[model samples]
Target chain A: MIKHKALLTLFLSLFAVSGLFAAKPVPPAKKAAPPAPAVITGLTAVDMPYDAGNAAILKWAVNPADAADTFYVVYVSSLEAGGWLEADRFVSSAKTGKDVELPFWAWDGSSLEHAVKVELNNTYGDTLPGSVFQFKVAAEKNKQVIAESMPVSVTPVGNWFRLDRMNNLVLLITIIVIFFWAVSHAKRKGLFIRRIAGLDAIDEAIGRATEMGKPIFYVPGIGSMSSISTIASAFILGEVSKKVAQYDSQIKVPHYDPVVMTVCKEVVKQSYMEAGRPDSYREDINQFVSADQFSYAASVDGMISREKPAACFYMGYFMAESLLLAEVGATSGAIQIAGTDVEHQLPFFFTACDYTLIGEELYAAGAYLSREPMLVSALKVQDFGKLFVMISVFFGMICVVLGAKFGWSAFVSSVLNLFQNF
Target chain B: MKLIKKQIPLAIVFITGVLTLISYYVPHKVSVDYIETMNKWENIVVAFAFLLGLISLFFSHYHKITRKADGWGYSIFVFIGFLAMVVPSYTSHGKQMVDGMLTPLGWSYKYIYTALSGTMFAVLAFYIVSTAYRSFRIKSAQAFVLFVAAFILILGKVPLGQIIWDYALGWTGQGVSAVIEWIMQVPAVAGKRGIMIGISIGAIVTSLKIIFGIEKQYMGKD
Candidate 1:
């Protein structure tokens, strides 16, 4: 009983100290008077190129409230002669917010007659107009003239695009031109594209799994349904499922997105029906895991381990999880074919998978498998566009080399300009 | 009836495509309104699509858990986690209940999913080293050249390359760095350009065939 009482006393003392340690309420700070308006902070004026005039940018800071009803009256004076003359007027209230830009007439810099002045105002009753002091900017009765900031000198820089940034534009145009050229060339010549060995290998892979009496596992990537890479993956899934159905081999499609899972089920079901093996297809074959990135990876990894499928197909846009999924399949001694557009993850896949599809090859999977004429035709056009771009690049290089000595050949410059402008 | 059933959706799609294309050029208030309407329609469609995903998820997992298949415990974990996320999301409450709840839950999700899963991926670093050590052996003269080029590229990308050889730093020299850039600019870009060209042509032809009814595979076999 004595020990229990002492323990209670100690607990009470600890509670008291915690309460004391709680932060003290901070005192309210004193409010400063709202700032006076029209304190000009910046001025930029430059001589207009190929013209007799100049352009200037004037900036000033004002009370957030005063900006609602203020107007700046700009005045100019010759530095040789002290008196100032009115040059331009800018109203602040007409635009969206506090910031306003005004255009003023250019003054020749040779004339010392270059000084600017400004003013601020608020709306009041009729006949209440009064002048506030020029320099002080503060007056009596809650109205005060704000002090003017030191005027800044303006330097004129013409509005011109940088040469370096134009290189990126040139590159973009070249890419587009090349893309179109290759496409057109392919279309005109009826390019006889060969069948991708990796595609024929899919059937062989599925057949081996069937022969071995083991199920096949397929992951359509961790990307959402809308991604092009994921869509391509779905197309491949359709083809794979058809093959699996014909072989009478069980196939599992573990999905990251629910919509993708539904689509996968439809495509799988359709493929089975088309292959005359509808009875062999199971709805359970296509499973929807969580949409959360890591959760989905864990679920897929779990599915792979428990199923221990003979063959695994990894197709879609993948991140860091690419290696995790591929490595696990490798460990299971399964033949893995992985395809993705993510360049950085390619090395991981190349090292892990039996067959790897590079960037645009993922898109080509449908064409390679289905041999649909439409797909082949489209690829042909894209090839032509690429060729066109390459030829243009070479031609432009030659022109630029020659034009360097001829003082800007118009034709060469124009072609270069098209690339630069594009 | 046929027109209403078939042509109406086609018409809607066509109109939508045209309007979307026109909106890029139109800068008018009416065009802005059309664009806004399209955006709102898309948002609503997306929201409804999300329900489809949710249902599929529940159905998929519910079947697994109820059947007591292998790893049903994981399904139960998923179901519980799904409920945990869904409950707080719909609970109309102050900042603490909604925002603060995600902190712990997200961390748990990350720990279970990313970090542990990433640890599995860390094996790649070792695997790559081992794979390179084993498979990158040179057998032929051509293989030797390829191997040397690969070595230079690997060296040039890392910081240690410049430390080992200053020539690797020169922009104009025909050093390893310059060669790597040339390879990327020439061969890599050429291949990419070729692929892109082929894809565009393929897409256009495919689209035309689909429209003209020349490609009927997508319509489901009779």
Candidate 2:
């Protein structure tokens, strides 16, 4: 009885994998066989990395030669759910032709790798957390399943960390770590930020203003409180107001924002207090003009013409009003020192102003002026970061040259691809 | 007072800032909703700020008029202008934006504010010409180069420039337009990109500083 049971088990096992064990006889050549649909060469499902689970990347190679109007019903089979299941995923796109809902279109047919991410959903349209999911893509033609993809599985998972964006995160952490490290080290050693010429000219400009007894006109940009440029301007304002307090030079700050006015008052007052001349600080020196841009420009122009301020500081964010203020200052023969993050406007400031800090130099102004160890370290780290970028740029240039001149473009591209965030 | 001055504001900034930072990485529902809430709060604060701004302006102008200080005569005009803008809005019930031309407030905005604003913008055109003349002067080698570039740009834009180039070159190569395109697409773009990269890095570092509370100069203290 045991031998008979064993024989039956062997027979069932052999029957289960009969195709693999023994080939079927070629019956009547091709006449008896029905015409099968186009073959799906490769069926692959990879876990869609860096996603919030419930999705699996399904890749397949389809015979473009036998392209016809047929819907490819895509599904994922996972044992976690009962058996085979359908999903409502993010990358399901349907555009006319086959309604396969391809995530992307193939520009080239033969060389195309059709990769789609199938999202698994429950009965109630909600994302199912990643499980061992296998892809089963079928070509349905005329209400019948004609061709089916080979059994291949890809389990969608929610990665706690995005491996693709690891490079960027690492670089950022490195920069911050280096910056703080430099800050702490410099704090001990005593940091020194190199003198910025534009900032250096501030003292001379203020002295001229004091000697002439002319008020110094300052425009803290048109932007509201959220702008970094405006914030940088405020930091610089603290420094400038201190100098104004020292020389007893009148400083006029016409504001574009009311909130900025409040902030500037505090900053100016702080500066005066720090300078030990708190009596010189006045609220009238910093007041909000009209919020209207052109009106503000007109008023500032009028003030510049009438008051004839000996020096003008057009710091922070600026727009079309940049050239207007700088030009009037130039014509009035006031020493203008302008620093802003706006690059396009830099040319205008450069032409019309006595000195202009280009782009990042505006951010570096506080450090340069304060020469505080903490701020100086930031500038130093920025310089170091710039050096790293410059080195990368140098290599990038060489790679481009070699890629263009020689046929070693693939290796260069591969290297470039590796450095990308994704 | 301590809470308002230090604790409460800092707490708000920290909580809101950290949430916003997290939202960039996690594209989940909760983060998105929280960000939306923060945006709503921002709008409300700005609205209140605008209201406060109006009051501040009134007080400042009032002081100037009452004191009869330097350029005090200008204060009366400001009051007159304020009334001119406000009275119409009052009549229009703050529906000036969508109110028809028949409404006095809308009419004032259309006829007066719009006209003045347009004129101001128009004046910038003349200023640009004057400034360009000063900027593109051929004094030094640098100035000479700038002058040449300016000449080419001006020539490339106008029809006369293309005509001159076409006549001179005789179809042997591209017209002034091609040279202009090359200059803009290559050298100009290169310089712009460099400046942009520097600005982006500065912005990133500054933002990190602000986020980490290392830089708090804007908070009205050291």
Candidate 3:
């Protein structure tokens, strides 16, 4: 009986061990090999248009099955055989061809493909014209590269014309033709320009300074020689200084830029010579105050307060310091004239200044003050340009409205594209 | 001498101006290189001009001090301030900070220069208030319009303004902020765009005048 019981226990123990072995979980069938991530297709490399042969645009069609996290790594090489260096990496959905900035006339951008502008100069220091470059793109998922595109090559060459800016070129040419026509016409028949009160008040301001026996202060507001407003101010200063010289009145020109100061000195000297009072032209008329904006304003303000100049002229580019200088001049009982192209600061000038040149008036001041045939013709050309723009805007509005109402998308887009800068 | 001073500069201006205009249309490598080189040259020229400016500043103050001009005492402060900053710069080898602590140069910039600049900037607030007072006095039809626009603009920007707007004009089913947006986007933008268009056309004409040598006032010739 004991032997039979022992045999049963041994059989049960063996059965239990077998059951444990049977219940063990199997390895997850090796994840079904992860489905082999889809590869990008139809890769093409072309030299970027409207560029200096230093960039190439790579485009490729992406498979719809690509995961959102799937990344594309762009590799570039001077040699086709090897030495592939990673140029850029981006997620699958990052860049599409539609995101390109080129106009429709230059590029046929499609939403179905990826596009990238690879700057060759960034990779190879300098990319000479007609230099061959090879590129490859690898699609990666879960940190593993799934597939690579066939190596595509491009020979970047500089283009002669930027087709993208064709509209701008056309407009520029039109303006130039108008300018030449206006110049010839002006010489034959003088152009008519409306009175600018600010420019008209120049003689008044200068005469007041002469009457008071106080110096005239000209603050060429904190702009470099390159600024158009500063150039205008220099011209006005020439005319004013000539008048000052004739009247034997003192004038002080506080400069913010050294180059402008240098230029203004020549202008004042010439004006004095023109007025036949060269002996009275002082070298200290033009002085460099400070390069720092507020410091210059403070120094000018202090001078205006102390010297009690009869008239003050603030012209050129001014920031917040506009009010600081203008208010001080106003408080000093000086007749102040201010002009700037900065639209936001116009209100401050209008409030504080006795005469304020708004927008184009500032540019027109030089021409108006000089009344030269050639200079006045430029103003007429500008007016013609304005008329052209007004007509274009009016016609553009009509066309856009008609196109939208009639479902003429192509016409609307063309009109809109003509107005677009790029 | 005429060739050197007048004709050469005019020729240079004509050549460079035309080339710059052409470069705007052309994307060729040579054109790009020319623009880059020209910009670098401009920076170098500006640096030398800065040196010239420093010399002029020194001479102007020096003359004032020597002559015992009206503000001779103030002129002495200019030299003192210039040396105070420049001496520390040379001694510290142009390092503003050393081991995360301010050097003498840095201290001067922070404690003295920036503080003075900030004080000057702070004074602008009072100036703005005075300007606004004079501007919003309802002197004419234009002034009335400006007053109304400015009042709306200022009122829509603050929390208290929004609360007052909600209580007063909320019945219109649009917020005061919406009115402000319309004023800014429609009327203000229209006026601004008009001015901008005129300015742009003027600028272009001026550029052409310079390029063609029609306007030589900058050359001080008439």
Candidate 4:
């Protein structure tokens, strides 16, 4: 009886411990399938012009909290039969945030650049069709999406106009206006401009050569005659040739362009005929040295040295060659009268030559020398325009100063914008 | 009769001017058509005019070469160079021929042209040195001022300037850059503005004369 009781007690204790340890493992509550990513919102499309090779920009809003413990995904499709084929698909961790522009190149071209848009999703589960996107604002604490935002459709419209092109509009208008005004003014009465000092100096220069019995060396610039300024130079050459003919002085016209040489020959011949000294004109009056800038300079320099001309006229467009020619003329003790619109070379000519016509003065030389009334009137109108500009500038400056002191920033800014547009 | 000759060209000028002005304001289909026509005609005229210069170039040089004038060899070289550039150009349409032909020829031109031209100019440096040694001999206050200005300008532009005046050339906050900017802005701008104002006034007076038919130089004769 004692042995049986001991065995029974041990069995009971073992059963009690087993029962205490055998509590069942708790099963997880069945999870509901994640809803599709709260429909995407804030879709935008813009056309980019610079890189038309093949591309566009797309952007959308994302929110992650709405679809329980879900990630966000994006999808895109064409408007054509290929309904929403994934152009580019990507997954996102957040459901409510800004995303960079994604590209969609399905129908991109010069015409169809801004025609694509995108859709977004928050569902981590399998996707279904015929579903509209509704974006939800994410809830705090658990970062759960609370309510969906109105879905935005992506519209592919590339940037409508270029920013750089807008900047050029005013400049283009100004150039056109200036050009037309001058041309019209010239047509009305013909241009009669004042006598440029350099042109005036030309007569004196050639006369001095006649008196001195020294040759007159004329360098008709180192550029082609087709250049407008060079044509202007050639016109001046006609006047110079007439004077040379009348004065019975020898003229040496060295050139760089073969075309310019022919034009120069014609101009000189015509001027001699007009001056009633056609018999005095010679082929040597117009000669081509070289098309090379420095070579021409060197050759001219040699001529200046050997011929020892009494008067040297450096007229036309010059570069570094200006200084070289000026220095040689200086060495040869020639009375140099230089006319050029090359602004950079002006200072060198100012330093070395007896007279130097500044930029634009060369263009004025024909009008001034010939007293072309049309040229003069165009210049007057240009002056009026300049006066208008100055008045506007002065008034604008005053307004700016007053505005700054009185704290009228908005008014000043608007005025500035207007001026900028003007 | 006088007005007919003078006024018509003026009328043409004014009409063209007004048309261009109207063009800027109007964005209508007619305006667009006019602009396109103008651009097309301009391009066509420019294309035709370009031939004048080219023909003149060939004729003038060919005459020189045929007559065996001074520098006839240079004329031949120029003709050959012109043909070399032109022949290959008319042969091809795009970058392919340019890559195969123009590039090589351009390279050769650069070598021959640059070297010959550069050597001719490099001789000037010696001439300048000698000229300076003689011409720059101190003569007057004006001459002295000129000399000093030239010296400063030339030295300031060169690499050795900073070497001589370390503090002057140093990239520190207070240095030559600040001074240079000040010089460019203050005196340079002032001088440029003054010159511009004078030029404007002169131009205005000239234009007035031109419009009144008081100036006749561009008309070929009195």
> Which candidate achieves the best TM-score against the true structure?
3
- Candidate 3 residue lDDT tens string, A1-422: 99999999999999999999899787676655565458778999998988878889999996788888899999998754358878889998877887788777878888799999998777666633337789999999888998899999998888999999998988999999888999999999999988888888989988999999999999889888889888888888888899899999999998889998989999999999999999999888999898999889999999999999999999888998999999999899999999998889898999999999987888888889989988998888888888999999999999999999999986887788888897
Residue A97 displacement (Å), model 2: 18
**Compared with the real two-chain complex, what DockQ does model 4 have?**
0.16
Query: Model 2, B52-84: lDDT tens per residue?
Result: 677777788889889887787887888888888
Give the DockQ-based CAPRI class for model 1. Answer: incorrect
Error of 4 at A368 (Å): 2.6
All models, DockQ values? 0.10, 0.36, 0.60, 0.16
Position A148, candidate 4: lDDT = 33
| Residue-wise C-alpha lDDT for candidate 1, range B139-205, written one tens digit per residue | 6785576567667778879888855546545645556667788877887677566555454444443
- DockQ of candidate 1 (2 decimals): 0.10
Runs in model 1 with CA error above 4 Å? A1-191, A405-413, A417-422, B1-39, B83-150, B153-222
Evaluating just chain A, the predictions reach TM-scores of 0.55, 0.69, 0.84, 0.57
Candidate 4 lDDT tens digits, A1-422? 99999999999999999988997778999899775545545554443232211233444444433334443323334333224333432334432222222112112222211123232222212232323322222222233443333323323222322333333356445634664677676777575444556667887888899999988998888765435457667767788878888889899988877667776777788788899998998876777666678878977887798779999988788888887898889889999988776666776787778888875676566655555445454454545555666886799999999999999975786456544531
- Name the best candidate (by lDDT): 3
For each candidate in turn, the TM-score is: 0.61, 0.77, 0.89, 0.57
Clashes of 2: 1
Q: How much lDDT does each candidate structure score? A: 0.61, 0.76, 0.89, 0.61
